[model samples]
Target: MEQNKTLVTEFVLTGLTDLPGLQVPLFLVFLVIYLTTLVGNLGLIFLIWKDPHLHIPMYLFLGSLAFVDACSSTSVSPKMLMNFLSMNHLISLIECISQFYIFASSANTECFLLMVMAYDRYVAICNPLLYPVVMSNVFCTQLLGVSYIIGFLHPMMHVGLLFKLTFCKSNVIHYFYCEILQLFKISCTDPRVNMLLIFIFSVFIQSFTFMSIILSYSYVFFAILKKKSAKGRSKAFSTCSAHLLSVFLFYGTLFLMYVLPGSGPCENQDKMYSLFYTIIIPLLSLFIHSLRNKEVIGALRRIMKINSS
Candidate 1:
């Protein structure tokens, strides 16, 4: 493989804007998105930390999710925003690789983290008596640790797979960021194996995760109905509604973007879908989690009161 080493000193990113007029508008929109993502995720992290009442397995998971969302959005959005301002959105090869790696890792982490959260909810509602035992701090840490480890590990393989290919052709990527799909057409080497690997993994992992969550929720729903009191069932359902919504939004868009048999996203459409996951979804998670969460609201009020006093 070293014989074909082009040394790959630089890559040119296509970025989100080929149109001059759209640059400022896109920049402003992304700027607002970036700001909101930062504040919302950071606020969740702070609320989780400050509120003693929120010191549960669920909040811990929420805190981890917020952190991941913040990192994930920052990984691509800031660079995207900068692209709008500059004359050329060209990024060096190493920088592009770095961007791809970060984006891939953070995104994969979110998927695994969401799975863990589903399991957490399953244990809570399906077997309340054993929730603490099943989701112990030690087990929770181990699950989260596995998610982070897999994040980088899987992407590292993909990057290595990419490294084997040659790219003497145009370096300009079609997407805003250095996405794996954009690298496919540029590779001088046959990308059959890489493409197959991506497709297979996408199907296996997403299906497994989705089915697991659905089965868990199914059991949870049945269990809730068995509860004699309406109030008890309502509380149980309420506790999981936000998570269900988050799960749906994240997986639905991801499936649309990746799972279907297509050539992948076009330049503009790619940017729009990318925005859904990278910026909007992350910001919405904060709202989704906090909207009906009295614990989070109370904590916010406490912080306000303390600050005011």
Candidate 2:
């Protein structure tokens, strides 16, 4: 797996904006986002660690989600922010590939972790009698380990295949950051195999995880309907609203990014939608789940009280 001719050692990233006047403003905006993402995620992790009430499987998954979200944003946002300030945003061949590998791995892990959390909620609501037995600490740990394994496994395959490609043409990437789809476009070699592999893995992982979440929630809805007390039903559904909304936003963007038709008139729009999946959705997780969590708020209050005393 060697290149016949090394055409380009580095690539110029056409960042989110080209306007010379708006560069500094955009940098500030993204800087704020990056800081907020870090604080929200780390705060969530700290709360989960400190609070004894949050020792359940659901919170365990939530903590894992926060960790993945933090890593995913950190992988891209720093470089993107740097690009905004610099005149030439050049990334080396090896560095670009490494960025894509880490970003994809973390993003995939978050997807599976979301599904696992949905299942946890379903078992807690629908099979309350067996929730403790079905999802013990050992079982949750195994699920997390499997989630990370599956996440990294598929991306490594594509990355290894990418090393086989011959990049001997233009060295300008149209996006704000490095991505596999964008990289595949510039390859001088036949990328049909890589394209097919991407399609298969994307469809397989998304369809499987989506189906699992759907089935779990279906059972949850049925169980909610069976409840005699309206209050109980409302409380149960309330807890699920946040998770359901997050699933919709994430899966909606992801499906549009990978599964939708790209050769049609909407190709550019497809790329824009992909930004939501890669960047915006991860930011949303901070606000939608962790920032508003009751446990996190309680932990903050305790920390404040201790400092005051």
lDDT of 1 at 176: 78
lDDT of 1 by residue, 180-207 (tens): 7778878777898998888888777778
lDDT of candidate 2 over 186-240, digit per residue (tens): 8788888998888888888889998899899889989999999999998778767
Best by lDDT: 2
Q: Against the correct fold, how does model 2 do in TM-score?
A: 0.94
Off by over 4 Å in 2: 1-6, 261-268
**Clashing pairs for predicted structure model 2, backbone only:** none
**What lDDT does each candidate get?**
0.82, 0.84
